[model samples]
Target: MFARLIRPLGLCLILALPALVFRLSGIESDPLILLAVFGTGVVSASFVLAWAAEAAQVDISGGLAIAILAVIAVLPEYAVDLYFAFTAGSRPEYVAYAAANMTGSNRLLLGLGWSLVVLIALAVAKRRTGKSIRALTLDSGHRVELGFLAIASVIAFAIPVSAQIHVALGVGLLAFFGFYLWKVSRGDTEEPDLVGPAATIGALPRRQRRVLVVSLFIGSALVILACAEPFADALIETGAQLGIDEFLLVQWLAPLASEAPEFIIAILFALRGNGAAAIGMLISAKVNQWTLLVGSLPVAYLLGGGGVALHLDGRQVEEFLLTATQTLLGIAALLALRFPRWAAWTLLGLFAVQFVFPGQEARYVLSGVYAALALGAFVYHRRHLLPTLAAPFQDHPDEQAAKAAEQESRTAP
Candidate 1:
């Protein structure tokens, strides 16, 4: 039993070996080489982080477990981006990298992450049922996530409008996260259907399970923290040498590396035909990224350097606008609690095009398109709009959920 568990755990540690060595030995390498080594570390450690997060379900409120897991799973991203935010205090140029990292992760999670999960789930469902699953339907407990995301999306626009990430806004976002956690903590505890290594760890005795979870969180966080600065710098240096745009590289590649675990885990869930769990996990991640991860940037900046806010340049502003709109569209698409095939493909399509035409004008057009679609979706699913936004704050969420379920069944064809 010990050996069986050790195999998977050791595999992840081995994958992260190069980063650990580089950090400790202070090895110097080419920019691309550093990128490869450090990026591998981020990706590998993130897998460990995700497993630890999943195993943590055994220790937390069942309804809130996924959200907490979502938060912990993306800590690699927070480490890397926050490093940039902290550095920006002295090196002002790093401010863009910080914003870029945040926006990229949020966009990648929602646009690519959410869509691919639904697409894979649909394919698997079709294979089993001989009929296409039109959409992935979420459980009522997810209403809290949607409501929090809805509020975050609206507030996110202020970043671009004000052209900065100010302390006050950070406070507001943090407050939202705090309230979200508090609300979720009150939910009834249920046994989670964990799989793979998470299942292995979760099956351990309570005391051992917690100790291991804490150890993994600490170990992976140390690995991520050690690699974060070097990885961010290597990305920029490598981009310059290759004549690729550094901002774009920071915007995309860094996120791709940091969010790899989340994408892989969510994909696995979809492959198991559990699209709702997969999508719900990513949605919760979005809420975390938009609120907690992002909200911490200015704080990190202030602690690293004396700054009241982090200023956003033109490009950063555009990225924030695009990210915010994509988030709103995601919320609107999920308003009816069903992520339809068309919406999946539509989001995937839009996400792809953003890279194909990376320009200010193109960005504005894309943002407008997202807003237009989101507005239309809210109108089309008008009845669900109010309920979704109000779901998190109800005095009796379980009873409300029951009523909603009853109503849904009555309206079912």
Candidate 2:
């Protein structure tokens, strides 16, 4: 009974956290907070259920999970955009905020999270099994995904600064989204196939699965958003207390907290030796943030008003540079293409260095230098790195199919 009740009760608390935060903040009971909470729960539930379904080898599309996650992830940004669109000067501030959040998040997934996973695996496996890390060979399917993410990141980074230019960028992002979906539909020959519908719904009756699908979808989203609000509020309040920037609070700390769910799921996937699924999910997240999130912001701004206009002060510029530098370091590590125990330690070192240092021009400059060194190391190791590390997980085709079959068989009975 407790097992059955925990998720629901946990979800309830998630829904209530924002209201609790507002109460603590001395703000009056606000309907927006409640609504946001509800939306967050619904979205989070959807993401969770879809993930469960996918893990069970159900026929339900994992794309739905990504889509729901993206939508809910952007809700706060959406709310802010609405506020700035009508009430504020220079409507473009909304777009700029969205860009920061999206780009920052995407880079975190790519440059940091991606490398961390492989590095951890290599280190732990080597320590335990006494084998060197092998190269992750990419078949056609993953090649496509890698290509897609790289292209999207480049495009998102290239969006011109002018408000007028942003409009075109939005349209381009939309087009890319459509093209991506179409490519997915065509199906990559090398990709593992999704679970069939019958198998997916077998665990629940048809009607029950339908209800579960809807409830889980909406409920998950609500929980995620609800949790996000309190999480954000707490971080902001704490950042103020600690004399840290709100941007750092949100970009790094809040995400570390709120995104725990996704990471937990990914870790589970990795532990199961479903490295492809783990990599796929991470890659999907980065691509979605880079293209879908960044792409849609300008469009959202334009619909709300003329367009978003944002100006970065020296402080913000320093922060962005720090983030970008860290990202470049991670990227350099990634381009080395081979996983090594040392790389993990190096990344941990870089991550640690940033936190220990005070917020000053000198500290940021040091960060930039570290990032540059990582990039240089990547270039130095290119021959050994690029060919070896690109795809760290590749089961033989027949073996992979056998694993899938075994997964289906266990789930079916």
**Which parts of model 1 have CA positions greater than 4 angstroms off?**
62-66, 205-208, 397-413
Off by over 4 Å in 2: 1-57, 61-100, 127-130, 134-140, 159-165, 189-202, 223-243, 304-308, 318-343, 358-413
Deviation in angstroms for 231 in model 1? Answer: 1.1
Per residue, candidate 2 scores C-alpha lDDT tens digits across 1-413 of 22443465366557555554554565643333443543354344434544444433333444444444444444443333233322223443333334345444544555466656665555455666688766432233443444455455445434432223265776787777766655554443222233322234435655665665555445544544444444444544555666876566455543443344455555655554554556556766665555665566656566655645333444445544555455445444444233344655665676666567747766567656856776686566444233332222332223343344355456644
lDDT of 1 by residue, 1-413 (tens): 44567988898899899998998999999999999999999988888898888889888765556566777788888888998899999899999889988988889888999999999999999999999678888887787789889988899899999999998899889988988888878766667768788889989989988999999999998899899989999999999999999988998899998888788888988898888988988888888988898889999899888489999999899999999988888998987788999999999999999989999999999999999999998887666777777877885554555565567667768
lDDT of each: 0.87, 0.49
Can you give the TM-score per candidate against the true fold?
0.94, 0.66
Clashes of 2: 33
Which pairs clash (backbone N, Cα, C closer than 3 Å) in model 1?
none
Clashes in predicted model 1: 0
- Candidate 1 TM-score versus the reference: 0.94
